[model samples]
Target: MIVESATGRRTPAFDTARLRTAAERSASGVTLPAVLPATALTVSSVTLTLANRAFECALPAYACSPASLPAAMPDTGWAPEGRHGLFVRNHDLYLRARDGNETVRLTSDGAEHFAYGALSGMSLMAVPLMRSQSPRPPFGITWSPDGGQFMSTRFDERKVESFPFVEAVPQDGSWRPKLWQPRIALVGDAERGDVEAAIFDVAKRSKTVIALKDGWRLYGQVFHWSADGRSAYGLVTMAALKAIGLAEIDLATGAVRIVVQEATPKWGRFNAFIYSQPNVRILEASREVLWFSERDGWGQVYFYDLGTGKLKRKLTAGQRTVRDIIGVDEKRRHLFFTAGGTDADPDPYFIRLYSTSLDGGAARLLSPETGVHLASRVPIGNAAPGSATTAALSPDGNWIVESHSALDRPPVAVLRSARDGRVVAVLETADVSRVAASGWRAPTRVKVLSADGKTPLWGTVYFPPNMRQGQKYPVIDAVYGGPQVTNAPADYREAVVTMNPRSRASLAELGFIVVMIDGRGTPGRSKAFNNESYEVFAELELADHVAGIRQLAERFGSFDLDRVGVYGHSFGGYTSARAILAYPDFYKLAVSSAGPHNFQGFYPVEGLFPAADYGDGKNIRPNPAAVPPNYARLDLMPLAPRLKGKLILVYGEMDENALPSVTLQMADALIKANKSFDLMYLPNQTHDFFRTSAYYTQRMWDYFIEHLMREEPPADFWLEIAAPSQTTGY
Candidate 1:
């Protein structure tokens, strides 16, 4: 296979054998031990033996799989009171006995496009990298406290439009290229399909569909099931995606009642409290429900009488928004959560933990540290420190495991008393000496004003290892400025750079300073700050990035503004391409891999304007005037003629997240415009790059070295990655 350029010329052939050898050599030197759980497990008064182990691993194997490849069902823990657990394998729900003896299939009609517990295709790509550690529960299932049944959704998308992708064939005749159809429901498509709530009774081996009102779409997974197993609760939004409300469904009659509804005409949609997950809980014993809402322009907690469907009171209120509900202690009448922009700290996005009571009094700060805190619920008897200095309350509500870290320090796990936020014991601390010895430099935290010139934006600067104080170095902007996530690391665990092939540190090792900045329109900030790009998605983000770059260059003399390169995956890919096309004089080179460039072309439904204007009504019909002009301005095809930088476009032939057609469309426009650029199509690869990350990393480094630095990279160079050992058990 040859790399194609717009000029109808082929670049030098890449030597895969030599590249693999170099990668192996590089992987062998990274002997840092794999991270282990800080606390030990104790079951039935038996303390299990635990040990720390390390293994070398190459890129994850999942990246090279075909587009239609099925992933193994994640292990869902056993039911609340029963010996059976639920899992989905090959689209069918199954009940497996804990003893490994009895296994029963629950649904036989479950198919690829239509299945129980299936999420929207658009949401599938937005799943975070961290969540990939465990298989996602099918369509977000919610099991009853009694374990008699479970509530989930059955998605019927058989009528939805399907996009086809061609799988790659091996050159040596080892495999053959095949066409794979991935079903996707575009926003404006004629057949958008439907999703219904389903309740499964384990004992009776029965299933019931609680049909929702017509012209509405399910918002998230089933929130919770009533204690008596007679009702299930969930959230739903209008077909136009404008108004949103909570609903309670009677199990026996399948009757639905809307508890609360909120709408925003300005934005044309109800403000989603949190992205990606349902942030609601049921206070079963009290007959009250705790739900998250942003009706007051800030995300906060609210209490509602479940029986009467009446608002009791707002549990949390202020300029700050609750980021997440960490845990709910019904017995103690306490609610633990994480909030941002509440503290007096300089960084408004730094998340801190807070706790309040069911009666809604003053909330007590649990984590007073000045960094981003991510808290979770600790197991009943486990005493290990939580993952970060973030607080994780124990089931009893008296203890919290605090995992603390900063920009310059690795995580130190400690046990703390929940009542007064006092440290009780140190469980473990990260050993980063090996990483330090490997010449990895901790990024310098930097704060710069946003393009508005008042709002502060946070970022990090990674310098070359052998840097000279007086010398200037070319810089590369490592961006993932997607609305869903902030690229900057707010904790120490993330600050510790490793030799991973996908990290910014590894890229910085190639003789260039790498920087990451989280500008306006990203999450973890105020609602207004995050909404800056609501309608002007493309322009706002790119402007902030440019402002950050200029600010960084002003603050530090090491950054060479004249020679700048940018690269990112997925959303970042879109940003990188826009960076060069929109600001041709600033960015000299860019690598956009799997970018959804032609947003209007690939998913026209998403491209529709007045975002809330949808459904079967004259007033809701698409208005071209309402559509953001940035959509066209950001599109690579329309801007192809304006391309003035050295751009290398990469795409996985089977990338389901950002379909390959988007990239092909951009290339086609570039070719038609008679512009010179390079293109690469990886066969059978997915969005994450997985096994192929090393190869792309090498290509990116070589591209920068050859163009930005005007230096020739070693011919047939390869990087060796350590493969995880099969013998070690953690």
Candidate 2:
């Protein structure tokens, strides 16, 4: 029920194996299965499409028609009409008819590392981290309006250096470890990968290469067709991470025209770009392009001439940040968007739906009841997962299904009028009465000042159930300090069992006051606030966390600050490990799982971390050779000598994203320093260790209880996934 981006802090799904154990102690007569069904409700409307025809049952015709609505082109090789498929095989592109067996070879030049439809560097890292079933992704293609042609990119990574991943236990049952070498363009590598785009004609069976030089890399770029389909547009970011340009491709000539370009001294990231929401859209009727930019210190929308690339006007201006362009009524010249910091709400992070004219004027608030109002509907066919902010407006752009929730509020989806924000109907309201009766408590939303005592910081606290006034509890900071995303959830899902059932609430149940903070340097705020930790990734923003906890201790007398502990995965893992090392006197213990101790050995994207204000403002440049001294300070190995608290390092032996080697380097450093620490390696597990999540959760729980609380963990209390019995309504 919460709105979050992919780059945000990771939330491990709560394992379902403990459902039986939890249900046994609940006072309410509610089963886990019963609660799940009640939370699955959406709008009472469904679209059934058969034989190229669609019917919207119990809904208006505008709800399901594509001709009347502006539909975004899918970033795949599938034809618009679904009559044929374009795919890559054996490093070359191919075309095949859906109803017939007629096949045509498009290109035969693709080979090895220079393959057609080769995954981007991010995708290459994501597949291993996600442990996807398919080793390859679909060909990223955008079909034309007529379905006669499509555009795609061919990846060139032959010049990129290769990194080996040796399988300790091969799936083929081989006695020796199998090695896999993937071409990863690490920072300082002279020859990084590039992408060459092409448009393929279905009938002519020919391809025309795009004529763009430089500024074209594989990651953070996807093509989309203009409203009229005569041209294709894409948001392109340079490899150096300092410039971004909106390029328009002429289908007939294959010439790329830069429509609008923006450069920054600091790193520029398309933080809002996704397949469902591309942050850039074309208004074909007016020959105007809608672009999202943060040049004004806040994310806002701007209008530009598509042909001349000249700024027409600023559609939005203020300290508020525009989260997404949810929908546009081109005929009416109105734009519907979601934004934060626009209203006078207690929590600045509370997002609300807004509408403003494309011609420019004051924006009118739509959902004004406070909290985070997400103007998104459940995605239908082939839509992206968690793509709630895109394609939610009904056809003709009159109605929107908005899901609203906050830290203490259960999610409720309602249908609202797009023209004037009026609630038409209440679609669903989550029933948490049973959960409340079962001793479930809502977390307290706490606001504190940053370490500087100037900027405000927000977070949440989960206390032990049935707490007494005079009792004190050990504090545990559940953190994710990655600059990419915030750690705290703004919705009622704080206690929901997602992937693994272990949550801050579950930890608090074990006699600790759990805290989740979205400290400084996280997104969803002003640009200055986000850049607080730039070039200081290794610092972990521990100063802000300490300041926040001290303020919370003064407000809540039940928090035992002396017995503080911290735990996180991925970047949070890096933070937790750094916390114990940087503030050993304050933090008693930490469980750092899969921390990127050394960024050089990690993903190639580390090149974007360094930013120095060379006076002109262009701070970020990918020059690893010039920053060897900076790397020395950023590396965690040198800080191992300062470790004084109990530290537990966990990693999946087969994790390819952070690589188990990174964790081993930390362990080796600690061993060389003659320090005592604990290490747990899960065999045959990937980055997330999905297969062994329950075991990992149990061990994490035990670590905090045994070390922080000074209590004995149950002897071999294994949380197992029990087989369903005949009476069990699973």
lDDT of residue 482 for candidate 2: 77
* Lowest summed lDDT window (length 10), candidate 1: 41-50
* Candidate 2 overall lDDT versus native: 0.70
RMSD of each: 12.5, 9.2
Q: Tell me the whole-model lDDT of each prediction, alpha carbons only.
A: 0.66, 0.70
Q: Against the true structure, whose lDDT is highest?
A: 2
Candidate 2 wrong stretches, greater than 4 Å: 1-77, 120-137, 172-175, 214-222, 227-229, 272-276, 342-344, 377-390, 432-439, 494-502, 538-540, 606-608, 611-627, 690-692, 721-730
Top candidate, metric TM-score: 2
What TM-score would every model get versus the actual structure?
0.80, 0.83
lDDT of 2 by residue, 306-370 (tens): 88999999998788888877877787888888888532468867888998998989999889876
Model 2 scores a TM of 0.83
